[model samples]
Target chain A: MMREIDADKVAETISGLLQEGCYRLSDDVIHALKLAHEREESPPARHVLGKLLENAEVAARDKVPLCQDTGMAVVFLELGQDVHIVGGDLYKAVQEGTRRATTQGYLRKSVVDRPFSARINTEDNTPAVVHTTIVPGEKLKITALSKGFGSENMSKIAMLPPAKGRSGVIDFVVACVDEAGANPCPPVIVGVGIGGTVEKCMLLAKEALLRRVGDPHPDAEIAELESEILKRINDLGIGAMGYGGRITALAVHVEVFPTHIASLPVAVNLQCHSVRHREAVL
Target chain B: MKNNMPIARAITLPLSDEVLKTLHTGDELLLTGVMYVGRDAAHKRMIETLEAGEALPVDLKGQVIYFMGPTPARPGKAVGSAGPTSSYRMDTYSPRLIAAGLKGMIGKGMRSGVVKKSMKKYKAVYLGAIGGAGALISRSIKKVDVVAYEDLGTEALRRIEVRDFPVTVVNDIYGGDLYQEGRSQYRIADLRR
Candidate 1:
């Protein structure tokens, strides 16, 4: 017999996650920042990192957002095939959760109605960028991430010919960070997605960031690549807030998928040190 | 060689040429006094108003403009998390504002070459605030009022009074750029050599 879960429960869980994600820096991310601060050689970069740590502490204590750009909510849902959602439309329920969280949490309403023409504020930060997948278990997993555009604006995607392979991927990812320079805010967390189709590659890259900081991919080869890419990025000397330092990037997370023989799509997604994300299961 | 330890300076707004000349790229500053808040939309509207030969909402003569769009304040708070936005978006309009006697700007990221040249030409300074440190930064703001374009919501023009608001000199009137100088200092190529 399949299990039934109340949509209200999901909504409430999402609301809490949204509020928590914005106010608190995840433990792993905080740890990474502290490590970066200690390792940073540039005094300015060290000072900036110290300020960021202090800011996080203030936001947590005061129950306020860590940054003014509380960011667009990006929700990742993993639903079980055996579970049935009851009492409300799934999408509407999630949107309502986001609305409630933004309002009750006193977070900023940053969503605009139209891209180019009308350009009106949505007021409640609604219509979250939601990605859903169906899986085997009876439990539903939800991860909420507040993605600030400063780093999102710096993301890049390129479809490389298969022959270019690993070197091509390395060069592209490094160049993206170099070009981004100070704009995305550093020390940054880089998410690299390799293989898959173009859109899938981009999603993979974003999802890669959901991994806890300092955790490496299970695959040895991929983990090695992650370390290499991370070292190269830090070597760029973009530093904290681009003030220059030894530790520009705290970590580089990579996600891979099988791809067609003709194509090797690579996407690089950068996250500022704020790195706000939280997860809940119901 | 520039010292690794950032030299701390205290500055007040409506900056003077003598004060501007003394600032160097990479110096840390505790800024105090009033500043106008404006972003891309506000800049565009201001520029349009200028082209129409109409008076700007806020006078540009000897004042600092902070590039930010703050979150709405909670009931008891002066303002919500208010932090600097990227300044490059204002590249087109800034030179005109500098020409109109704007003395300083607070924002993150780099400015265009034209904007830098104009800052040097007009004796203006560009200050950088920590990008994601909004909540902490907001604590420095003691007062806020919507000066113009309330309809713009978060993008509305705001007049805010701050005390010891933290920032760093990213671009100075002497053609110095902290982003370039700082990064070049730690680049792997140079460090290896």
Candidate 2:
């Protein structure tokens, strides 16, 4: 017998998560920022980090958004194979949840109907970037991230020849950060996706950002790569808000997937220090 | 311990040449007075209006423009969480505004080379407000009014009066860029023994 999960319940859970996620900075992110603040040698960098931490506190205390952008809603769902959703369409439920969350939370409506030509506001911030995967369980897991476009616009990808290898990946990622400079709001958290097809690699890069800051990849070799890439990036001296400082990046999270023998696809997804995300299991 | 103290300077808007000359890269500032808001959509329209040989919605002479699109204000709040957007998107429009007597810009990120050149040529400065510190920054914004292009929603032009709003000098009239100066000061190669 399959477990029957009401779509409304999922919607409600997601709505609550969205409100909380937008208002509250996660502990790991807060911790990493505080650590960065302590370690930062530049006075301006330290001052900016101090203000960011204070901003997080004000948003949490006042029940307001951490940043005005509030961002386009990106939802990651793990649907259980044994669970049957009832009462409504799952996607529609998610949209409904997002609509209520934005209205109730006072989040910004950032989505537009078309990229070019029309450029009409969607108003409710609907049609979230939903990525759903099937898993073997009865529970549905959802993660909601408020992805601000300031950093989103800075994200990039490239296909390197296989022979370039690790050094190639490091150089490309660092170069991306160097080019981004202050635009993406430095003291940035870098997410790297290595291998996989073009699209899959980009997704992997974004998904890597969901990991807690300072948490190393489970694989030792990949973890070392994360550290190396991070060191090179901070070495660029972009610092806080590109004002220059010792701490340009808070952490680098890398996620890898198997790819074609001929392809070494890499993607760099940058996240601002705000780093708003929340998850719920229904 | 000695380097930890930031050099704080207070400035009033509608910036004069004296103020512009005093500003240098890396100086922290708290700004007070009235400023106008505009973003990409408004900028495009402003340029179109300029091309038509018509006046802008607001006179930009001797004024500052903040690159931002704010969240809607709830009841009892002056404005919603207002913060700076990236500055590069406004690069094309900024030179024209600078030529029209715009003296300063507030936003996060680096300016394009063309925009920086215009700043130096026209005696302007670019200040950086904390990118993600919307709520904190909003406290300093005491008044707000929609001045133009209301249909643009958040992208609409706003006339705002701010008090002690925090910012840092990113680019100054002397052709100094804080982004380059800051990076070079702490680059790993410079720090390595």
Candidate 3:
């Protein structure tokens, strides 16, 4: 028996999530900032953390956005094969929802028609970068990540040889952070994708960010590696805003998929302390 | 412990070496009075206008210019999420702006050698607001009026009067750079160890 999925419900969910995610900083992110504050040795870094925390609380209380860059809304959907979307074009519905979210939600309209030349705001943040996947059963999972461009511009992808192994992965990831320094904001959450194809690797890296902060990988070997990377990343001395401190990264999340025998594609997606993401099931 | 520092004292006064000495990396500032707003496009125009032996659209003396391309403000709002962009992009134009009597800049990230050298030579300073704290920062700006390049939309040059805007001192007239100084402290020598 196929389950019926209401399109209006989906649209409402999208609008609600977009507004909530844009305006309020998440608990995990705020907790990470607080932890960074306690661990930060440098006075400047500590002050920066305090300001970020205060800003988050004030923005939440005022029902205003935490950052001015409300960012392009990215939707990752996990649909149950047994569920059917009713009454409309799913793509159009999502776009309309995004539009409403932009105007009513007061999110910044960051989307432009083209990368160059006719660079004009689309007015409404439409045509969200929607990633849909089908799974068994009747439940639908939707995750919205409102990404700011400051950190997005600094994201990098590299394809490495199989020989680089785990050590090489750690080195590459740390080096990427070192080069980025304070640009992406320190105490960053590093999303690492290992062993997938080039494009898949990037997707996996970003998906890794959806994981709860400080959550370890299920695989013992992978979990151990995650711990190692987290330790080394924090040791990078690129404390809060590169002020130098005990903590540079709040967490290192690694997600892996089987890849071609000869390829070890790695992607590093850096999210600043203000990692604005939220999830809802409908 | 916080002090009840008045916002007026910080914003309207002419910035000098003596005034700058009191600030440090990570202090909250609520700048009021006046500041200029310009980005890549207006910067080029300013330089070209200056090279043509013409006066700049706005006087650069005793002022701060934020490097930003903000979203349009709401109906009654003065500005949208108006936070600083990366400072490195404006490194080239900054020296010229400083030479033209610019006293301060607000942005994020580390500046290049040339920008730092110019700040030292010109007795200017660069301040950093929380990169993503745009909403909170905008609350300080009481009024915003586009003084030049209205066609540039969000990137136009504006004369904004703020009340107690917040920022951290990144590069000062004494040639101090908090970004570099902060990074070296966390850099690990041997990953294996």
Task: TM-score each candidate.
Answer: 0.97, 0.98, 0.90
lDDT of 3: 0.79
Q: Which stretches of candidate 1 lie above 4 Å from their native place?
A: B1-4, B190-193
C-alpha DockQ of every model: 0.69, 0.72, 0.46
Which residue pairs collide, candidate 2? Answer: none
Error of 1 at A233 (Å): 0.8
Q: Kindly list the per-residue Cα lDDT of model 1 for residues A11-108, writing each as its tens digit.
A: 89889999898889989989999998888888999999999999999889987688888899999999999998999988888898899899998988
Best of the two (2, 3) by DockQ: 2
TM-score of 3: 0.90
Fnat of the models, one by one?
Answer: 0.67, 0.82, 0.55
**Model 2 stretches with alpha carbons more than 4 Å out:** B190-193
Docking class of 2: medium
Tens-digit lDDT string for candidate 2 (B49-113)? 99999999999999999999888777888987888999999998999999999999999997899
Isolated chain A TM-score, each model: 0.98, 0.99, 0.96
Give the residue spans of candidate 3 off by over 4 A: B1-14, B17-30, B40-56, B70-77, B191-193
Q: How accurate is candidate 1 locally (lDDT)?
A: 0.90
- Residue range A1-282, candidate 3, lDDT tens digits: 989888877887888888888778888888888877887767766777887788788678776777767778888889999998898877777787788888887777677777677666577877689999999999888887888777776778889998998888888988898888778866688899997789999998899888888788899898998889888887777777666677878898999999998888999998877677777887
